[model samples]
Target: MRRAIDWAFRDRRTGAITVAQWPNLPLWLFAGTSLADWILNPPGTVAWALRLIAGASLAWWAIDELLRGVNPWRRFLGAAALAGQALVLATAGP
Candidate 1:
């Protein structure tokens, strides 16, 4: 159990536990569009566009994390985030 835990969290090179890092490009895009969507409160079309962009960027980020994360915790976080987004979209009414 201890060995498994260490394997999941340890960085191969640095021997540090790495769960997350600074935001990457897709994350940045998601954040920017989310902020714009909240602050600007644009008209219907613009609002939809912002939401679409935000969702797409977030999805891209999630996929990248799932595929390339440095640690198991990071990969789990990505999976959870992706699932959460899917839930939101599923329940969001037209």
Candidate 2:
């Protein structure tokens, strides 16, 4: 189980990028949780915090993609989603 969890967080791929690869599972889980929170709850402190965390996480994913040169599509999508989330969250009523 520990090995599996460790595997979840480590990426050892080195070569041309392939579509077969998935994004980091643990990060995706965290991203999904934040996205679900936004989908399920009213905009407030908790929601804002979740969005902030989500945006940051997505941004990290994007940067990691850039560094690894693995998935350009994921990087752009993550960056765009992060920007939109940050914009809406920042503009939202308190």
Q: Give the alpha-carbon lDDT of every model.
A: 0.88, 0.61
Shift of residue 4 alpha carbon in model 2, Å = 36
TM-score for candidate 1, please give it: 0.86
Error of 2 at 75 (Å): 6.3
- How much RMSD separates candidate 2 from the native structure? 9.8
Q: What local lDDT does model 1 show for residue 78?
A: 84
Predicted model with the maximum lDDT = 1
Please give the range of 10 consecutive residues that has the lowest summed lDDT in model 1: 11-20
50-69, model 1: which lDDT tens digit per residue? 99999989988888888878
Model 1 residue 60 lDDT score: 89
Return the lDDT, model 2, position 29: 57
**TM-score to native of every candidate shown:** 0.86, 0.51
- Predicted model with the maximum TM-score: 1
**Residue 20 of model 1: what lDDT?**
72
Clashes of each: 0, 0
Please give the range of 10 consecutive residues that has the lowest summed lDDT in model 2.
8-17
